[model samples]
Target: MLILGAFNLFVGRLYLIPSESMEPTLNGCAGCDGDRIFVNKLAYLGDSSPHPGDVVVFRGPDSWNGSYTSQRSRNDVIRGIQNAASVVGIIAPDENTLVKRVVATGGQTVQCRAGDPGIMVNGKKVDDEFTEKPMSNPVDPATGSQACQGPYFGPVTVPQDNLWVMGDNRTNSLDSRGHMGDELQGTVPVENVVGRVEAIVLPFGRTGFVDNPDIQHN
Candidate 1:
């Protein structure tokens, strides 16, 4: 058990999906059991870095705090226990961690405009097959794209060492797009990434490796 705990703490860990933000790609809901996923902490070690289309777990930037609620116990004793359990992957750590897909990396420019079929990175339309099917949200009249919902934004260049991220669920996700007013233009620092989500490991019926396609090419 001690060895397993150490491994979980430093190598990889299991995390439970708590919301539908990444829906269709990762199953999560309010009341039922969410999909359990394995995050590979070693994925970006050495010279590797997250790339566009890779789903990752990361610490939310300061601008995102308003949307998060901590799950730590108020009592010292219980909180300590929870902390210990989290080390072993028994429960999620009490932190503002979020999961989303990388939309554009450093030096790339991303945007959505009127009549665009999907998001554009470096002026090329990204393939939208991975996004939620039959998008139900009211399309943004300004952008005319269901992907943008109501906020058509950016040709904004991603800062060096930062990442532009968004959820596959688009309309339902309060991802980088929603925090564009911040200093980093809603981009997450590469340093804040906890790990790359590699696979779904729980809820037997949905177990499988998560896809990380080259979204910028299409």
Candidate 2:
């Protein structure tokens, strides 16, 4: 078991989708059980980087709910077990390490507008056909007023070596768009990426290769 665990940790690992952040594309949404996915750690062993539309597993920044740091808040033995279990995909390394889809890579501009197929990258509309609902902000259902208002996020360019990521369930996901004011300005550094999700590995009914969206920059 240890050997298999180590191999998985260094080469490929499995992850259980614990939230609805990537719903409709990767499951784990409200009232639905999550999917287990295979993450290929060697995917970028040749110094490759994440591409737009690839679902990736990564260690989020400090401001991303302190997922890594939270371990420090746990009992030593429990934390140790969690870490060991993570080697074989028993649980996530921490709550902060997450799975999200890359929306824009370095040097690209991305924005979310108030309309159908709401996301645009590098001035080109992404073919977002996987989502069940059109992108819309949370609003007061009674009056239809936006629950919160601002500059409407992005229209900002991703910095070199950084990536703009989001969930397939756009409206409910707190992704790069929600982290705009952080130290990384809502973009995750390329170095933080762990690997790309290759396929669903559990619940036989949902096992399959994850589809990469057709993202164009015009």
TM-score, cand. 1: 0.95
Clashing pairs in 1: none
The per-residue C-alpha lDDT of model 1 at residue 149 equals 49
What is the per-residue lDDT of model 2 for residues 1-218, given as tens digits with 9 covering 90 to 100? Answer: 78878877798878878777787788885566679999888887776888887889988877887444554336889778777777776665655778898988999998855542457787677766675354435544343223112125567799999999988776667789888889888999988888899999878999999987655533
Model 2 quality (TM-score): 0.82
Q: Write the per-residue lDDT of candidate 1 for residues 74-101, one digit (tens) a residue.
A: 9999999999998898988888889999
- The candidate scoring highest on lDDT is 1
Off by over 4 Å in 1: 147-150
After TM-score superposition, the amount by which residue 120's alpha carbon in candidate 2 deviates from its true location, in angstroms, is 1.7
Q: Which stretches of candidate 2 lie over 4 Å from their true place?
A: 30-32, 66-79, 113-117, 134-151
